[model samples]
Target chain A: MMSTVLAMAAKDLRLLVRDRGGLFFTLAFPFLVAIFFGSIFSGGSGEPRQLQILVVDEDGSEGSSLFVESLDRSEALSVELSSRVEAVEQVRRGKSVAYVALLPGFGASLSHPFAGSPPRAELGVDPARGAEAGILQGLLTQFAAERLQDAFGDPSGLQENARSGLQAIELSGATGPQAEGLKRLLTEVDRFATTQDTADGQEPRSGGQGGGFKLEPIRIEKASIIVAKNGPPNAYAISFPQGILWGILGCTAAFGLSLVSERTSGTLVRLQSAPIGRGQILLGKALACFFACSVVSVALVIFGTLAFGLAPSSWGKVAVAIACAAMAFSGIMMFLATLGKTERAVSGVAWASLLIMAMLGGGMIPLFVMPGWMQTLSNISPVKWSILAMEGALWRGFGWDEMLLPCVVLLLVGSVGLLLGTKLFRWPNA
Target chain B: MIRLAGLTKKFGERFAVRSLDLDVPRGEVFGLLGPNGAGKTTTLSLMMGLLEPDAGVVDIAESGPPTDVGVRRKMGLAPQALALYQELTGRENLRFFGRIQGLSGTQLDERVDHGLEFVGLTPRANDLVAQYSGGMQRRLNLAAAILHEPQVLLLDEPTVGVDPQSRNHIFDNIEALKAQGRTIVYSTHYMEEAERLCDRVGILDQGELLALGGVNELIEAHGGLGVLTITTEAGEVRSIETENPVIALADWNRSELETVRSFEMERPGLERVFLNLTGRTLRDT
Candidate 1:
């Protein structure tokens, strides 16, 4: 029986070597699929887009000019000048992410403020790009608030007034280190106020003068950017999973078709007639299919790593994952072939199953973009688990804890498929 | 010896073979003669244990035909289809099958050479089967089947689609096997082959055996009288009655039918006997 199985497997291997076209379709096609999809997901050539914002300067005051100068230093926004109508048009057309419209207000309003209503700035933005637009709007609003305080010359006056009021209350004796810290903070504010006046080219105001206020310079230090400790987010990372999924699916289809051909050609019937048991014959063919799938998987992995820079942290784990995946696919394919009585039917079912699995398993699209329900539903597909397990081992830097679930799922699916396949598999046309 | 008793097989609603009973004695060439779909192939399949019988038993020698490994070791089957791998060379295919049948190393190489030589394919033994002609491939197919040198050989339409030269070579090989005291059960639709080779022939039709006997017995039973023909000039004609007309006519018509262009006589061939029993020409069906 062992000899019969070995003989059958050897014959299939010989046939595979003789037929160049079959070898290519079985072994090389998967790597081609990987390269094709890898290129698409890696974002091979397009430049990244930057946010564009239009600044409308209706407030012709020096304070507004300072605000515009501050906006020019922002790295997040590419600022441009335009009329309200032009800015609104640009925002509506998506040419600019958002428009900053300064309302018309003369310099006389700030000199005689009565606090009836605060001035308003209008921001025009497209809703589709609303999130970024909103963030930019918040940043600009804070800038405007700072500029308004600078114009009024009372940025720290409110803090100083609160401190004096608290001192006057004297709820407890002000003899502790807390009182000394408060005094030090007040003196620093005074020094900042003095510097602000000199920087603005204004004379210092007297301490006891009526309606006198001071401006304290507050320095806003932007955060030092912390670059992420990883390679650039690539489209290939996503494409790699897709390629692996398709590669396994292709192996299943290719091997299933070969089995169907053998049945049609009467080679399988002849094998059955030999002094071999049906179980031995089926096992022989299954082993051949498994070997073919493993070859294809190896080819795909080599090409993926070399051509696309897809490096797996653990080669051993990746190999095991690929072997399990190939075996699972082989089992499913052999089962599908047995269910079919003809080559056409087997090919049709194999192709349809492959496409369906590819679609559901994030082969063509990333699972992150899929709806939660659909993502959950993908657990039923072996392609999904296999891809996830392979990606976890190869690209994702996942430890065994993270990788264990997908591997277990894939193995379970493989076992079930093998059980059903062995039971369902028939010799030739049954 | 191959023996089958009450062996039967059915496919779905159709009974392919029904209670087939026969014994192919050792050292004799047994022929199974039947038209297409007449249970000949089905019975062969059952006897080879390729298909499970719906009823009864099939045995080779003392054992049965779910033939044990020991019995399988002593049996070789040449199915109708080309069973040898097309991508392997003739010798390689023989060696592979021989190994599967338990031969190995030097023994395997020797058997492979002998098998290829038996089918007169030793010269082309190293050429791939795909490179061989249909007749050469058919011969190689037979070679692979007989590579293990089994005690009994089951050949199912072993000469189909072969040129006459190759067919004669195959027949010669079978005769040599028979001469070596090897039991053989040969199935074919060729009546002339049955007449020339078989020690006993079983005529099967519609899943049932219509007749079973030696060549001469079958002919004498179905064929009422012998036939004799003598072609001569218009003026020379004569009628002669004798059980052995060909021998008697040679002496009688040596001078009388001297102007004869051709003369032939036979105790009616297997074809005639088949047509007489089945009421239809073997070739017509």
Candidate 2:
């Protein structure tokens, strides 16, 4: 019995070697698809580019220069020097993100004591760089507050004194209190200047404040992606299932033809007269198909690995999965073969069924993108579970825990198919 | 020897073979003669254990069909259809079937070689069945069936589509097997083959056996002693004019017919016997 099975298997292998079309479909096609998909998905790892700014100082006085210097030190903006006209033109032309224009304070306002209004800086920004503009505005406001504390001398009284000074200047209608407030603000700025120096001296903020952008730092650490456990996502996972399905489909077509030929030729009648039992004869044929399907599965795995970088971590699991898949597929082929009376009928039905399973079960399309209902529907397809189990072992780095379900499903499906196949199998010319 | 008693087979609502009784003794070739759909193949299937009989039992030697592994080991069968693989070479097919029949290693090699030699396909043994001519394929098919050298050989129309030369070769091989004391049950629609080769013939029609007897005995009992045809130089062809053409033809002188190119006479062959018994030629449905 062993010899019979082996002999039939050997014969099937020989036939496979002779069939170039079968080889291409079972092996080459899957490897090619894997390579194609791998390349497409390869670039999913790396971080996204920072904004540049320019500051223009028109007033040349201590206050204008200090404010300009503060803006230049900001982490969010990379500050550079330019004339006010040049800076505005740069921002408008989209070369620099935004321009800071320190207005001419003329220093006289700060020389007075509580006599005039505070000086203000004008910002020229490109609205298109909305995120950068917002960051610049926030930094500018913080810098102003720090400068106010120094000019007022008393931290608690700074806000009130600044406000009262600006109000008096506005009421006088002569810019007297605002000029004094501006002078007082300049005197306070000198005191706040020391804090900037201290923080800068401390840790050299590597572009300051945790690398500028407020969101968590995006670091793309590259590691090999396993779509399944125990292996890298590669062609073998896809092709192995396809090979099993096609191998069985091919066997069905061939065996069905052989059966019809035998009946038409009358050999079934002759075999009937022989001493061998029908069970033995059927067993021999089924064994032949099973062996053939296994050969095809192995070939697909080997070539798929070589061509598409499919590497399974565990050979033992892969072998088991292939065996179960092959046996189940062979059973399906035999059962289908028995159902049809003519070779043409068998071929048509078998090919149609194979295509449907292939398409639905990730043979032609990845199951990841399949709709939820379709994914659930795939449970009934042996191709789906076979592919899942094989891929899980090879690409998904699946341990026994992850692998158990698919394997069990495959085994159950195989047993059912084999039982049905054997029961339904018919002898030609009987 | 093979024995089938009260063997019956049914297909849905119809009985293909009904309570068939048969005995094929050791060392003799028995022919199961029938027209199309006469349950000849069905009976052969029952004997081979390829089908379960609706009733009765099939025994090969002393073993029942169901648990007759020993009997199976001693049987060789050439199915009515071509059973050899088309993709494999003649030798490979023989070896494969030989292995299935329990021959292995050097034993398998020897059996394969012997079977190929017996079928006169030794020269084409390496050629794929697909590459062989129709007659060559038919011969190879026969070789595969007999690779195990069984005690009982079952052949179902083993020479169906072969040329006359190949048919003769097949006949010679069967005769050699018979001479070696192999029990043979041969089925064919060719009445002449049955008449020439079989020691006893069982005639079947419409799933029932019409008659079963030796060639001479059958003709004597059912066909009125046989027929003789004589052709003369007057461009006239006629069967011998007598109540018993067998007696008249035995006394005809070839030299007396000076204008006759050739004249031949013989006992009624299986074809004539079949027509006499069933009112139709074996080939005429």
Candidate 3:
């Protein structure tokens, strides 16, 4: 029995290779789907989209420009510098999610550091977009902290200046060591204020803090992370598996069609007369289909990873995933073959159902972009489980246990399909 | 030897083969003669164990039943349609069937070679079945069935729609199998073919066996008369049936009939027997 089954599978594999149409659907079409879908999702950037924000610098000072530049450094936010009027009009017209304005004298506030009045920055958000509003508001505070840190670079120096400014405000200045500390701290502040004025292209007032105590301002120290915070997001990792599922769908359909073909061609009748059980014959054919689907799946994975740069994080899990998925689809093919008695009927119904599953399962569209309910409904599609298993094995970093759910679901579904198909299958023209 | 006792099959309310009883002794060529819609194919299917009998049993030699693997191993069947993977070469098809029949290695290769050569397809063994002519495909189908060399060969209209050359080739193979003392039960819609090859013939129609006997027995029991005919110079023709054509012609001449232009005799065979029994021509059905 085992030998017969192997012989049957070998025959089917040979036929698959020689059949151009079958090979196209099982192998080539998958890559086409992957390439096309990957291109669409990536938009040539190969990265997921980022949150957008507009920055309106009302002050036109060095401090305001520095703050906007800091916001630009964040990975999550994409900031566009615009005029206050244009920013306001853009946000009001629903063109931008929100905008920030840095008022005049914002640059001068840097001179006193923590001791002076806080920098005046206004964040305007659209009331209609509550999610965007909250996100932009949180990002504003983070940007503000980063801006302050870069501007001073010397935290202890800023704190000392702040203490001296407070003492000057109180008058009756400190005596002894504290008096000298205040004197030197005030001089640092005076120097910072001079730098600010110079940076703004304005003349420094000679008597701003008793004149001659102020030293010449040096360059403000800056530090930044020169490397990327994250790696490039590959759309092929997601699309390739979905494309492979398309091939699985095609493979299943071909298997389904084979049952019908056997009947029409009188091969089923011949097998019936052979010294074999009915279950054995059906199983042999189904095993052959399982092989076809698995071979096509592995081939698609290799092609996708090589040609399209879709790398699976764990090849072992990928092996298990493809096995389960192939079995599931093979069972589905048998079940589909049972639906219609003739080849034409079986193929028609199988393709229609498979296409629907593929569409819902993220073959044609990413599930992330789908509506919440559609995503939930897609749980019923076998293609969904197939793609989930593959993606998890690929970039999703799924371990053996992590990969179990989708594989189990696929195996169970496939087994059920096989059971139903076996139960319903009939000899041709009986 | 194959024996079917009250074998029956039904689909819903209609019976495909109703309580058929048949026995074909070892080394005998038995033909199932029937027309379209007859239960001949159904009976052969039951005998081959391709289908389950709703009512009775099929015994092959001393094997318990037709469905048993031990019995099926000793039986071969060739259906009317070409049962082959068209993409594979003829040799490949033979190898596949040979393996399924439990032949392997050198044994399988030898049998495949023998089958290909027997079918006169040795030269085209490497060509795809799809590329073969209809006649060649039919011959290959025959080869696949007999590769295992079963004791009993059950053929169901294997020559339907086949070219004359292929049909003759298939006929020769069947005859050769019988010469080898294999028990053969053949089924066909053509009465002439049945008469030429069968040692004993069973006529079936509408799921019932109407007649069963050797060619001579059937001709004697159901055969009516030999026809005597004469065409006069005046273009008048007259015909009569009798046990003796010579006596009928003597009577015609004694009756002072006009000068005959030509005369001919027609003999009663299986066709006439079918017509006499069923009141319908063999081709009409």
Candidate 4:
């Protein structure tokens, strides 16, 4: 039985190799896509892209000027000083991704121990540039966290206050006012320990009658950004996995169409007439498709590694992720093959579906840059899970624990599809 | 030997093959004579266990129903359509089917080579099947079926659309297989091929067997009359059907027949038997 399966698989592989069109889409197409998308996202050297952020400092204070200088020195953000109206207009016109504004008298607000509610920086951004806007917002928040923490007087002393305050709360096991405030402070201290505090999310306050300043929380104009101290991974590292997935999908479409072709050509009936079981026959075809899809994915990874310098965080995890993804797509091929009676009908439907899946799954456009609703909807795409798994393996530093969810989802898809395909499978005559 | 005991199959509301019973003795050459929708392919599929019988069982040589792997291994089928992968060489396609039939090692190689030689495709075995002429592809399809040398061979109109040369080549192969004492069930719409090859024939129509007997026996039993075609030197042609050819010829003018440039006399064949039984041409659906 095993030998029969292998023979069938070997025959399919031979045919797959002979099919220049399938190979072209499965292998070469991914490389071209990777190059095109990767080069567009990165300069192809795998270095992180510098986000251009225009700054208009209306408060001619030392602190405001210092903030602009620091933005220019940061590795991720490229800052340009511009007038408020010009910067806002540039963002509105799509000329720039975002602009940060220093509200008037921002310097005295920070210099005095909270002279009033800490002056907020007005961040005007173009929503179309969601990814770049996210990064710029994170940078601005980090800067704000640093200034807020500075208002408390020495960093070590503040951290000591936060650390001991947490110990007091723990020892007391109390829901007292000091502990509640300290719990929030400890969360802030954790952020502070990493780099700068969660300044974008910090609470600022005006100086009350007390000798020290009371912090008041300031909002940064509806901006929501999570500060990643390690910064974002290089764009190619992100784009290459999507390219590999496109290659896998291409093979899935090819193999799915091949099944319909086999039935139309009557070879499927010939195989059914043999001594092999239906399980063996479908297994052989599934194995063949799986191998083809896996090889395309692995080849793209190798190309990305050797040529584009994509160093995945863990090779073992990537292999497992790719295996799961290939299995899912192979099962999908079987399912789609059974959907239509004719070869042309199957090909048309399968390609259209795969293209839509790719579009929604970050194959055609990056999910990060899409609108909020679109990004949320993309979560439903299996391609998104595949991309997430692969990104985690490559640059997200996803260990097996983090990789298990996508792997499970992918395997579930494979199992369900395999069941449907097996149930619905038919020969040309039968 | 193969047998279908009260076998049945249905498509939607209609029965494709209903309560069909058949037996083909070992080493017998049985041809399924039918029109387009006569359920020949459905019966073959059920017998191969590629499809399940809706009501009854399909048993082979008392081993078991065709669902048994051991029984399945004993039979081979060459479908009406060419089943070879166009992208693969003839050798590869033969080798693949050979391996599926449980042949491997040097045994697989020798059998594939023998099949290629038997089908007269050895010279071009290395070429892709897409590049092969229609006749070559038809012959290669035959080779793929018989590479494992099964005891029972089911060929379903193996030369449906091919040039005359290819058709003749296929005829030769089928005849050779019959000569080898392989129990054969061949299906086709062509009457002459069945007349020349089948030791016994079953005429099927509307999902039922209309007639079953030796070809000559059927012709003698149901044949209406023999057809006579005469062509004059002026390229004019005429056809007549008569029960007694000798008397009919005697009644005709000798000079008129002498002027006939070409003459053909077709004896009662499967086509005539089918027409007599079903009152429809073999090509009619």
DockQ of each: 0.29, 0.36, 0.58, 0.55
Candidate 3's error at A32, in angstroms? Answer: 1.0
Which candidate ranks first by TM-score, i.e. highest?
A: 3
Query: For model 3, how does the per-residue alpha-carbon lDDT over A337-429 read when each residue is reduced to its tens digit?
Result: 989878889889999999898878877786654554787788899898888788777765555776788899999998999899989988764
Better of 1 and 4 by TM-score: 4
Q: Supply the global lDDT for candidate 3.
A: 0.77
TM-score of chain B of each: 0.87, 0.88, 0.95, 0.90
Question: Model 2's CAPRI class?
Answer: acceptable
Question: Per-residue CA lDDT of candidate 1, range A1-430, in tens?
Answer: 6777787677676777777776666666665666676566444332323456787878877645666777777765567889877776555433456677655552223322221123445666643243354466567756655655554477455345434434543555554454444445444445665555445654333333243333322222211110121121344545665666666776677667777777776666665655667677667767777777776677667776777676665787788778778777867876787778788998898888878887787777665445557777877788888886776666555567767777777767767766787788776524
* Model 2 alpha-carbon drift over 4 Å, by segment: A35-307, A311-317, A320-324, B12-15, B225-240, B243-267
Worst ten-residue run, lDDT, model 3 chain A?
Answer: A222-231
Minimum summed lDDT over a 10-residue window in model 1 chain A is located at A221-230
Off by over 4 Å in 1: A1-4, A44-234, A368-373, A428-430, B229-266
Task: Report the lDDT tens digits of candidate 2 across residue range B68-159.
Answer: 77777777778766776677788887876776677788998888889888988899899988899888888887887777778888888888
True contacts kept of 2: 0.53
TM-score of the first chain of model 1 = 0.58
Cα miss at A417, model 3 (Å)? 1.7
Interface RMSD for candidates 1 onward, in order: 2.5, 3.6, 1.2, 1.2
lDDT by residue (A7-107, candidate 4, tens digit) is 87888888888999988888889888888887787642223366666888889889778767777888887688998778866665334667888888776
RMSD of 1: 12.9
